[model samples]
Target: MQDRAEETRRAVLQAAAHLFFERGYAATSINDISERSGRTSGAIYFHYTNKEQLALAVVEAHFAAWPALVAHHEAALEPTLRKLVRLSFAVARAFRDDVLVRAGARLWAERRSIAVEMPPPFVDWIATVERMLTQARVEGDLAPHAEPSRDAPTLVAAFFGLHTLSDALDDRVLIEDRLADLWLLLLPGLQSCPAPRALLAEVGAAPRARRAAPTP
Candidate 1:
């Protein structure tokens, strides 16, 4: 009975994520989710009290699954900057393929409608980038003048803009190319020593080997 209940909950979240991604939160309805999942209204209400709660669930699920996706590619020890670059590619691929991610991205714009204050994805992302930048500074991967505290937010905002453009254009490859171009443009000023041209070239290359598996 417990397993069956869990399955029902998963099905509702999956259906809701897809609906929310295709149509913004205000446009989606409880009936829409129910219809998509082939579950009764009672089943969805069992897991989520309302559409707002369901939308929050989708965002929570998106972030909850992200660490595993990053960890999958980060198993081997590598240069800090290289790791950061690889993670960006992995995230882009995930954004392209994962409906949960798309839902979360869509939900971010509609967060004002959500009653509860959920964990903000932008804050989480900035913190993650800050940690990576701090460590890179410690390891002398970054230039002497490059301050992680200042650069972290900048990088996060820039990447967010790039990702937003990708979503608008519906061309993930273009964002990947733009990110590689961004690295090439910034690395010279950011790296302690001359940035590896090869690293810039390699961004969005073969690193999809650890492509994130879609969350069920």
Candidate 2:
């Protein structure tokens, strides 16, 4: 009975996340989640009191998985600068590919309408980046003018701005490519000489070979 209930809850969360990602908070109704989950309204309501609660659950589940995602991608193995770059790519990939993360991001964007007093995942992201930037500064990887306190939020803002633009264009499938371009623009100011190409390779950022000119 407990296993069945847990399975039903997971199904509801999965369905709600998909609906929330596709329809946004205001447009996604509880009945919509129930229909998609293949569960009755009673089952959904047994777990969540309302749509707001369900949406928050989706967001919470998404954020809860992030640390494991980072570790799985080996973000901890690299130095701070490389770790930051790798994490940026990992997050971009997640936003592009993961439905739960997509739902969480959308929910946070619509938090004002939802009116729930939950913790924003962006705060944790910014804090993590700030710590990495500070570590990079201490290790002399950052430029003399680089200020971790200012740049950490700037970096996070730029990342989400890319996501917003990608959403507007309806082509988030290429977010990883966009993040690569962003890292190219950001690395010069953020890293010292050499830019740690070794660490970059671990994150799959190795530069492509130059193509030969086509014979006329």
Best by TM-score: 1
Model 2 C-alpha lDDT per residue in residues 109-202, reported as the tens digit of each score: 8899996666666787788778888988887788788888898899999998998888778669667666676777777777776454454576
Off by over 4 Å in 1: 72-75, 171-173, 202-216
All candidates' lDDT scores? 0.80, 0.82
Model 1 residue 206 lDDT? 28
Compared to the true structure, candidate 1 yields what TM-score? Answer: 0.87
Global fold similarity of model 2 (TM-score) = 0.86
